[model samples]
Target chain A: MNLLSIVLYPLISSLLIRMWGGKNPKLAGWLGCVSIVLSFVVTVKVGLHFFINSSLEPISHNLLTWAILPSHAILFSLKMDVLSFVMSLLITGVGLLIHIYSLGYMKKKEYGRYFSYLNLFIALMLLLVLSDQLLMMFIGWEGVGFCSFLLIGFHFESHKNMNAAKKAFVVNRIGDLGIFLAMMIILAVLVQEKQLWSLAFEDIRTHLDLFLTKSIFGMSLATVLCLLLFIGVCGKSAQLPLYIWLPDAMAGPTPVSALIHAASMVTAGIYLMCRLSFLFDVSHFASEVVMWVGIITALFGSTVAIFQRDIKKVLAFSTVSQLGYMTLACGVGAYAVAMFHVVVHGAFKALLFLCAGAVIKASQGNQDVYQMGGLYKDLPWTHAMFWVGALSLSGFFPFAGFFSKDLILSHVHEHHLFVFVLAMIGVLLTSFYIFRLLYLVFYSGKKRDLPGYITPWVMKAPMIVLAFLAIALGFLWTPSFLGSIDLFPQWMSSLYMIPFSTHSLWFEIGLSLLALLFSAVGLIAARKLFVHGPIADQWIKEKFPKLYQLLLHQYYIEEFYYKTFVHDGPPSNRKLSQDTAFTNSLFHFISVIKGMFDRYVIDGLVHWFAWIPQFLGSIYARIQDGQIQTYIRWITMASLIVLFYWFLWVSGMIA
Target chain B: MNQLFCLESYLVISSFLFVIGLIIVLTKNNAIQIIIGIELIFNAAALNFVAFSYFRPHVTEGMQLSGQIFAIFVIVIAAADACAALAIILSLFRVFKTTRIQNINRLRG
Candidate 1:
């Protein structure tokens, strides 16, 4: 398969669907599915070829020369080594399943538009992962962000959803600025060093020594570059400060949440870090910053997830937290471990979201978990799949997340004890929140009567496949003690040459046991508190109203942001009257000045220019009176005066 | 030279005709009288052109009749103009029941 076709298939189908599939939604949905399936098949073919030839060189094909400069040319190229192969497989594979799920999930009227956006999103994400150059990757990066905004505001009828989509777009743009600056700085440094200007990952790696030795603003250029890149990472992956968009991004359709937010697009940051692992490997300070930021975000997200009432919001925050773990792994220079966690988390998080979608559908779009209970019997398949997802997410033994998360925790343990402790707390919170959600939604008995909505087989099939992955994907990278090959890490090790920090079998087992213990503790605690229903929540809410409000309001971070940046002025309840009075007067003075300037300076100038034409037109109006004889008399008199003056001048030859 | 055929005599006659035409156009109330005054002014200009061509001191052999040709072109244009002006006056008479210039001032600004 031509690698470019992997990106093209979905893009062409998106345009085709938009052009032809407007009236027949079924055909549109099938078209979208078939294109993604073809892309997936191509990815699998590439993967199989790589598997058969383990020592095969990273496959690179330049589709065309995108730009030619005096020094070098920028090629629109694709590369499929182990990293791109893994990510391509994940994007196309999960993307295909989500497209199928969307068939049953989306309304008929929206089928064409929704599938077009989904396919465009898949195409962009494949482009993001497969592109060999950073410039091409950035294009894919922005394209996916745009697609996310479109899909999030798919229901444009609601102002709230539109606001959420705008928020996501604007926030991602803030991170995108960081990436833009980083690219400029890279190009500038290359030019300054008299090196060929190339942004391909391989080229950057080959010239990594140039960046490491240089300094910008009294800091290592590599550190600055990596830190700037991390800002982009923070935005796309929904880490600290920039993570506000992801939770609100739940306004999108559930399949969008499953595919873009949870499975594929959100992990692009991790993929980028892994792709450029060579650059990051040099900057210890930047790596520390990455690690700490990840830790805080992990804790923040899991804690916020615990308090969220909306099922999708909870999954959204859990995705944020899991993304934090992957970032943290990348920070520790364990790019392989991060990639492992990325693939596993993509599978289970997508499964979890799909299950949540089924529940929300069954409840007729009631996302509030408080309103749902005892759904196991009604939605047996969804319930079972949710359990698989929740267990995998919470790092239960032998599940996908257990292997990946434990790998991350062990790597963090080797790096720093404090980080390891914080990560353990994050693990406990992860288990607590996910189980709290699971129990609240499914195990609290019947909270109220729900409309009996059957889960369609179309939705059921994807969930079934995902649940199997969530259960068995752990075997792909089992610890040595399990006597299984660590296939995922070995596959990734070729791309990320960082040596794995090895430990004894007993030490590894101890760490896994400790993580399992935390998981169990969180589960038992959730069962104890939430098994009965809202009584425990009511008691807690009454006992600690302030704390409850804090958690419920997401630590008031969104509110703080709104007040500080979005609000025009201080609220009316001011503590300092004198200060408030002065500021108010100052604002009034500025406004008055602005009003006067607008009235006199800007509008007055325009009016003054307009008056010229009006004044001349009024004077000229008298001559256009309709009497033809009067006009003839004026012309004859004027011509007589000119003739007399000319005769006198010509007689004397006057100058 | 005969006084009636001299260039000065022809110039004086045409100028006098032009002045009279101007007076008629300025004082006329009837639309037909104004049309007649315009035709007079055109004939005065054509008469001057023919006088200049006939009396020129350095008239070339091929260009000796150019002034007469211009006079012929002016006479043809004046005839077409008279026809169009008379048609307009006839339409005006239908609309207002009179051809007086002052009464047909509907196009005044």
Candidate 2:
């Protein structure tokens, strides 16, 4: 099957599900599930074909031209390189699992709508990955955003869910503006200098030298465009300042959290950076900004996750933290490493979310970790799956996160030690929060004698598959000391090479050991804090009240935003009682001017403009008075006058 | 034919017919009288064409009967126009109960 068909298959299924899905939701869900699985099957074939034939350049199939311009045009095409193939596999493969899991998770709800949204998300994500041109990708980009909004607000009956959906969409829209500006700048620069106005990934790479040479405001055009694109990345991938929306996005269903937010959609920003790696490669300043923003976001999210008691919110923040690591990878010019982490993170994080969904289902919608206890005995399969996911997430040995994340750390360590130190701290917090969540939910306190809820095999099946992937996919790429086999990275190296740490093998091994040691410390810390009766928690609350409160309140970021955006004016809130009469009058004068302009200048122009035709039409209305004799008399008089003039002229008397 | 009537005489007859029709139509208020006036105008136009053709037999390159054909087409079109106009007048008169154009001014705008 063609690569385009893989995207179309799920879209066709989504439409079908919506049409015939009202009365029989079970069938609709299955239909949606089967379509994604079929796409995944085809993706597997395509991926294998690409990997087996190493000589093939990125195969592009131009479906049609999207727009024809005087200078250049963009094609509605699909490209299946190793990078896209990997992303496509992750999307469709993990998407299928999430679908099967949703069959159980959303069993009693509007299965038709849920499954249809899920199917559409997969289709759009595939479109995003497979698109050859950035313009074409934008369609899928906005499409996935819309689906994210729809799914986030799926339970629209509640005000909180609706608010969360709106926040996610509005924040993403702000980032989308940045993307649009970046695209315009790139196109404009290329057209001006190189006479090339194309949006294809290949074209951009080819003309990147020209783009780098062009200067805008004393900054390279490449730097400005890259920074603008990074803003879009911050929005989609949940980096600092724009990271607030992802936590609130936990209002969505768990499968949506797993598939769209965690596995695929959030990774779109990373994919974009990787696709435009050539641009970043030439812009050191922009890459530094990307690296710093990423590490800060990593620290920020993981810190907030430590205090979040809600299970999904913790996972949501952890997803943010992990995405920060990927962005950091991109920042360091480790494009292949970033993509490697994307694939590995897709597996385990999705696994973690699905397991959390099961736990939430078992707990009867109780999302707070403190509310539940001792589920390790009752739900063994879920506990086992959640353990695998947690281990992988914490970068434990032999799991997917370890290899990919260690790769990122080694690269960072080679470049900047301080940023590497910050990233290590982020890793420590990641493991601590993940383990804190694990121990608090599964191993702490006495077992509650609750009624047994049978989690259907459908949900368990996907978790089992994802757990296996979380454990095994790491072997695809490993460091030098562990019988180094760089399979995945080597396959994707044709797009952009991931700069391996030039440090010695022993140093690389030492870095891996440090990662392991930190994860171990985090695990032990979580154990001491959360395993027994809340002794450490109480001691911390009592001894360091302000710090505890600060962590608990998320450093009051939301309150700060609300105060600035919704409550008081910016200057007044910044300095209390700073609003003087002068400022007030200034504001008042502006408002008065605006009001006058709106009422008089704008409306008066419109009214007079309208009155012009009416005034002229009144004068012209006399000709058609519906009086036959009057019109005939006028015509006769005019004709007689004309004839009199003509006779005199012909007699040569008017000269 | 040229001995019996000259082009100038024919032009005077047609012009008189046209002026009389225009005067009668402008003065009258009845719908039937207006229709009679319009028929007179049509006949004046057709007579002008036939008279020109009769006086100047071969004015164009091998197109001797062009004016007569045009007059025939004018006559045919006038007959159709008269039938449709009379039918419309019948409907208007039934609705307003008047044959006078001034009273039957439903289509004023």
Q: lDDT of each structure? A: 0.88, 0.87
Instruction: State what share of the real interface contacts each candidate retains.
Output: 0.93, 0.71
Q: Which tens-of-lDDT digit does each residue in A387-445 have in candidate 1?
A: 99999999998899999998899899999999999999999999999999999999896
Candidate 1 chain A weakest ten by summed lDDT: A569-578
DockQ score, prediction 1: 0.54
Model 2 per-residue lDDT tens digits across residues A1-655: 3888899999999998888886788779889989998899888877777657766477777788745674476668898988888899899989988888888998654888888888898899899999988887988999999999999999999988998899899989989989999988877876777777578888888887877777889999899999999989999998887877888899999999999889999999999999999888889999999999888878888898887779999999898889999999989988989999999999999999999999999988889887777998878899999999999999999898899989999889888999999999988999999998999889898677657987899999999999999989999999889888888878877888555667798898899999999999999999988986345656878999888778776787765564444334333244523444455556667778989999999999999999999999988897887888879899999999999999999999897
Q: Which residue pairs overlap in candidate 1's backbone?
A: none
Off by over 4 Å in 1: A68-72, A567-655, B1-40, B43-109
Candidate 2 lDDT: 0.87
Leading candidate by lDDT: 1
Candidate 2 docking: what grade?
A: acceptable
Off by over 4 Å in 2: A533-539, A567-655, B1-109
In order of listing, the candidates' clash counts read: 0, 0
